[model samples]
Target: MNSRFRRRSLLNSSEDNDPMSVVSNLFDVAMVFAVALMVALVSRYNMTEMFSQEDFTMVKNPGKENMEIITKEGEKISRYTPSGNKDSSSGKGKRVGVAYELENGDIIYVPE
Candidate 1:
């Protein structure tokens, strides 16, 4: 038999049926899917950080006795002490406000 014909017959024979090819193909497909999922997750996380603005104009800067927390959605939550007293009153001393910049180049403080 010719070499080409012999090779073709060998490939067509049942003994040449290798199960490793199926396993290797499945492994390749799974690897591709895993890489795609990881990339998607990383992209989504990066997009969230990109969309959130961290900088905000100081509507009121907190002093040593006060605490100010700014949210990613531009909401400012402030906690401060009463005028001269050292102790804090939850109902009377705590103040909440929203910080926004006005069109006239001024920062507007809106009490919430």
Candidate 2:
């Protein structure tokens, strides 16, 4: 009778240990890691406004030839790239401001 009870207990323990449980646990861990990575990246690049409902603008690689201007307004997003022209104007608008880059790479805008 003791041997029969031990055999039944072993079978019960084996049944409780499902192989699929391990896979599910691994999937949960992966999802948590992915979320953490996304949060870190967003904060690192100051991109938290991207998830907000208000309008926002972002400049990537500012002052460089490959610079990109991203603007989000009222559920619409627009991307503007420099046309490789030394003068950044459409030849129709009057100049309203001037921007100067400081030695520390900070840009200052002075309205004319």
Candidate 3:
């Protein structure tokens, strides 16, 4: 059986080892890689669009006098509630409240 199989293999090498097989496999791998890259790009765009309004900040080793509050929206950013200044005689003034206008033409007041 082994002798017959070897004889057939030697006689018909074209069926077992196609010259285009290597090229076809490489093309398949490239197509898969391109598809994966496309998927990753689309997901990244969706994630950025969905969480566009959401933002955050960090305060490292805040001083004892006061703390700062920061707000961000896209490229525009705003800071609120500045720290206390020792030179000022009145000291740090407390935050009474803040009124924000919504996109749907509504006002919301946030109190500290």
Candidate 4:
């Protein structure tokens, strides 16, 4: 047999099938799956704005006692929560509109 053929056969031999190579392939597939899952979750919840450089404001658990307001402006982020006092009103702003939450969690605003 030729030397080049011998070397090619040696490289293609069953004995060269290392178990570690299988593990490496599995690890690569797992990394791809993890990245895909992260992208799906970000798009599912409309959370792409959280990763952008533009200003955005998001409300979590709206109309609940544990509601949270997250605002991002420039490179700064701020979170606001209620003080748990239901009887206090401090702002001088007038009520220009009324908002009603429907059964499907959609809000409708009606101007005064």
Instruction: Say which candidate scores most in TM-score.
Output: 2
Q: How well is each residue in 48-68 modelled by candidate 1, as lDDT tens digits?
A: 443446634232346654544
Instruction: Write candidate 4's Cα lDDT for 5-104 as tens digits.
Output: 9999989998567879888889999999999999999999998988899999999999999999999999898999987986576575788999999999
Residue 73, candidate 3: how far off, in angstroms?
A: 24
Query: CA lDDT of 12 in candidate 1?
Result: 98
Please list the residue runs of candidate 3 whose C-alpha ends up more than 4 Å from where it truly belongs after superposition. Answer: 1-12, 47-112
Each model's Cα RMSD? 11.7, 5.1, 10.9, 6.8
What are the models' TM-scores? 0.34, 0.65, 0.34, 0.58
lDDT per residue (tens digit) for residues 1-112 in model 2: 9999999898889657799988998999999999999999999988888889999888999989899999999889999997897686668688899999999999999998
lDDT: worst 10-residue window of model 2: 85-94
Among all windows of 10 consecutive residues in model 1, the one with the lowest summed lDDT is 73-82
Q: lDDT tens string, model 3, 51-96? A: 4676765443366445665556666666666646657756567669
User: Residue 63 in candidate 3 has what lDDT?
Assistant: 61
Using TM-score as the measure, name the better of candidate 1 and candidate 4: 4
